[model samples]
Target chain A: MKIIVCIKQVPDPEHAKMDAKSGTVVREGVELMINPFDLYAVEEGLRLKEKMRGEVVAISMGPPQAEEALREVIGMGVDQCILLTSRDFAGADTWATSYTLAKACQKIGDYDVIICGKQAIDGDTAQVGPGIAAQLGIPQITFVRKIDEISEKNIKAERLVEGGYEVISSPLPILITVVKEINEPRLPTLKGRLNAKKAEIAHWGPEEIAADKDKIGINGSPTKVDEIFTPDLSKDGKIFNIEQLDAAAEEIVKKQKEMGLI
Target chain B: MGIKVIKEKCTGCGICFKVCQYGAITMAEKVHTLENGKEVKRLAVIDLGKCTLCSECVKPCPTSAIELKAEAHKFEGKENYKDVMVFAEQRRDEFEEAAFELVGKGRELADKLGVNLYALILGKDLKGKGEKLISYGADKVIAISDDSLFNFLPEPYTNILIRIIKKYKPSIFLAPSTTQGRALLSRAAGKIYTGLTADCTGLDVDSSGNLLQTRPAFGGSIKARILTPNMRPQMATVRPKVFKPLDRDPNRKGEIIEEKVPADLLKSTTKFEKWIEDTTSAISIEDADIIISGGRGLGCSDNFKILFELAEILGGAVGASRPTVDEGWIPYSHQVGQTGKTVGPKMYIAVGISGAIQHLEGMRSSDFIIAINKDPDAPIFKVADVGIVGDLFEVVPLLKEKLKRAING
Candidate 1:
């Protein structure tokens, strides 16, 4: 089995803070980590590789710092890592990003399966995987929680839905975006770390992947931000720093009662 | 600099830093003593490597501190595009609530743009579903039935959508940003070489007649107004519960066109084996008058019992923040956030939830929000109509007792 995993670097959601004066999120000391969802993709890829005795390659499309995300995956036993970086690729939405990745896959030209996280935590848009499948004209099964069977030619998986799950099967060269419930990702090993350190990450640009200049970057992205702003909740609600919890509780009950809400 | 932060105007408010999904902007501290012996902080710094020139940090800056190079381009042929088309998603003959919401929103936008509101329902045995959409405000409902579309397969769905889009040339296309919506729309947009904004919280037509799609990004820290300026079908997606469905009007007059898609276009490479629907508890937060949601501060899954007990007394449903669901304290169905569900209740009570931006996006639409947490400065306080800075372990039980007595009496 030849596996390709698409991962991303996102701000850690754990270490969140608010600016005291402005009440905005403080971005300082906000470290970047692998998109929590992508860890499952890497884990699933490695697990498949381990079972099938094949290689898994990791790919990330972001700035140079995104190399750290690729390195992390390599340290988790991804056989190869590739960083799809270019000035033109900046501001690319899922459309162009998926296209570029599909082109890279064509450049690699030998892959039985591709994997990605169900959604990037930062964007939470589960579009790129299906977009890539569309760009490559291949089938894609998204929101997969469990893989029941797999081989070089075909695979079966359970997809998460509103009520429960659905069983779906697809031929090889198909793409899949997995949910966190798929597997528990393993930590990087000592040997994996050494291998990652010596591994040469192939940096591919549009030309390197034979991508069209018109379809590789912001120019290729159809969506544009007409405006941007914070989601300011300016409702002047009341705040009670309760010195006496029991009394405040009673007061709240009385207040709701007066308002006819109780 | 892909994007520059002007130091003279920046107040170090950190809004830009938070809104940036790429983690490109970081605060740079430079303290200087003023004549009054007070210190002032410097502005944020942009990292060229990480900045994608998405211009996310440019406008939200109160001081207008950020600037970026503008791209120059020209477009034509969009003048021929007309009307607003919404994909009225359905499954097993039942239309999703989002379908009606989109139709309602689409009707509003179409009226504003002086065009028609068209809805496309693709499912097997969906003969009369289009009428429901018409009652909800669709000017014309296009019903296309096929066994292949009985269950959503992206390839076939996209093919049929592309065919309809090419034929009708709608100025705008809208759908819910759900599992099938995102998968099908993105793939269709890609094949048709158009744009599709995902999970839009707001959609409207500008004075210039462009679909202004607003959405939360960067873990819901900030909102972006997106535009497919030149695309024929300016497409966008919204999550469930973002917009309210208009009251059904059976007397409303509309046309329902039963359409047929080519068999060749309905080919799917993936095979669907079977669907297993889990029997879910009959706890609906959408219709609930009051929702008492818990978070990580509850300590353990066992702590959720406190919220449940309080909810039971209050005649409300139980809700959980994403962390609680992710931690397995509660199921994902009870989770309220961008990824889980968007809800609007009469009153939302947040207990032990130090709200993340994602969590805030879900419940901020409630009529009245009361937050109870030990952390006085939790983001949940920002949106709460009533913020109580107290430990939930102490305040919840007391509040529950008082409310129960007051209600029963």
Candidate 2:
């Protein structure tokens, strides 16, 4: 089984800022990390590789610095890493991004399974995973919390729904978007870090993947961001000290009563 | 400019009918003689008399059966679209409360736009549920009744919704930002080629008729208002509990249109095996009225038991910060933050939570907030209506005793 994991390098959202005048995200001077959720995907891929004796490849689409994320994943035990970076790929929405990733998958060719985080925190759009599955015409199960069983030909997993969990089974060459409950990601060891430093990172661009110029970036995206502005948070409230804890609790109960909530 | 169904590609999914606010599309059984003299199937038919040529139904046809006769002329301006439509999501044969909440907000937006408010409902044998929606302020209810729709599946649901949008051409579309809603609406929006604002904390229409979608940006440090000025059928997914539902009026009456779904379109690549409800968290954190959440400051997983006990006494639910959940102290379902679940309860009590912006993003909208932390400078105190600068272990036990006595009295 050949398992591929898709990861992304995101500006640490905690420190990420937005340019007020331009209404665009400002990444300068911000710390970058492997999208926290993607760590679980890479770990799951590595675990599956360890169990099934197959190679695990980590793929990421971003600026050149995204190679850092791939190299970090390599240290987590991935056999190979591929970085799909290009100027043409900038400003892509979920559809265009998924299209490019699907094209990269086609270039990679032989693969039994693809894994991705349920959503990227920065975009907060879970569309890319399903969009990739749609583009590849493969079965996809998103919000997967557990892998119940896995074989060379088929895989069964428990995916999260609105109110419950659904156990779904899909054939090989399928895509699964994992949630945080899946497994705890392991830290990189000294030997693993040494191997990561020596590993060769493959770089692929639009031409290498045979991607269409019109469909690889902003031009291919259907939706466009028309405007962005800061929201008003001007409401005022009272704050009390620890000595006033009982009084505050009493006031809250009183307010709840006024609002007809027991 | 009217919508046309390609006979060969028509799957009769009835998504067109479900979305049509004008009741223009209907599923009818048609017999066609094969070359060998065999008869066949039913298809969706469009009534030109009732159709307003909105060209909204073209996208949701599973097989791409529907098309606008003149694509360029179909959407000449925003004037062609009318009314606000809310996707009334259902689960286990019942409507989610968020459905009513969206309808409530839809009602306000529709009234502002001076158009009718329509609720698009899809489910299995949802008899009389349309009436319930009407009581909650839906001017008209378009329902697609099918057994396959009992559970939310992205492909079929998205296809149906896209067809509805193409046929009815609602000016605004609202869906609850739940997991199912996000999946369904995102795919449908992609097919419809429209901009969708996800997890909006606030929604309103500008004087120029553009939907103003406000959501937290850069991890709750700031809120951003996003707009899609050049798009039709403005789409937004609203978080649950942000708005209150209207008072129910059983005496209210509205029109209900029922549509059928084609069996072929229901065939999907994925299959559902079984539903396992998380019995431990019987009430989801999103729906909880009062929430008692703990954070890493609580020390360890065993410390969570006291918070759970406090929650039980308060008749509320237990919630945790992302760190505690990441530490494996609690399940992800109990997490309250940007990555976990956004909640707006009546009252939120934080025990030993340091109030990271990410954590505040989820619970900031709560009506009343009280924070308990030993550190006086914890960020949580900035947003908390009351701050207790004391040890949680000592403060929590005292507060719980006071609450138990108060409730008993």
RMSD of each candidate relative to the true structure: 5.3, 16.4
Q: Write model 1 residue lDDT over B156-255, tens digit each, in one string.
A: 8888999999889899999988778888998898888888899898888888888988887765556778888876688888867667889999988999
lDDT of 2: 0.78
Docking class of 1: medium
lDDT of 1 at A4: 93
Candidate 1 residue pairs in clash (backbone atoms < 3 Å): none
For residues A106-214, write the lDDT of model 1, one tens digit per residue.
Answer: 8877888899998887777788998898999989999898999998789999987665678999888899999867888999999988887888998999889999877
- Per residue, candidate 2 scores C-alpha lDDT tens digits across B1-409 of 2357777676667777754434567888778654566555777888764454334465546688876532121235777777899999887678899999998999999999899899999988888899999999999999998888787777778778877887788989999988888777766765565667777878899888878888764454445566656668888888887888999999988899786667776766666777899776657676678899999989999999998898888778889999999888998978887677667788899998997767876777787888889997776776777677888888888778876776666
Q: Cα lDDT of model 1 overall?
A: 0.81
* Fnat for the candidates in order: 0.68, 0.33
DockQ measured for candidate 2: 0.17
Q: Which structure among the candidates has the greatest TM-score?
A: 1
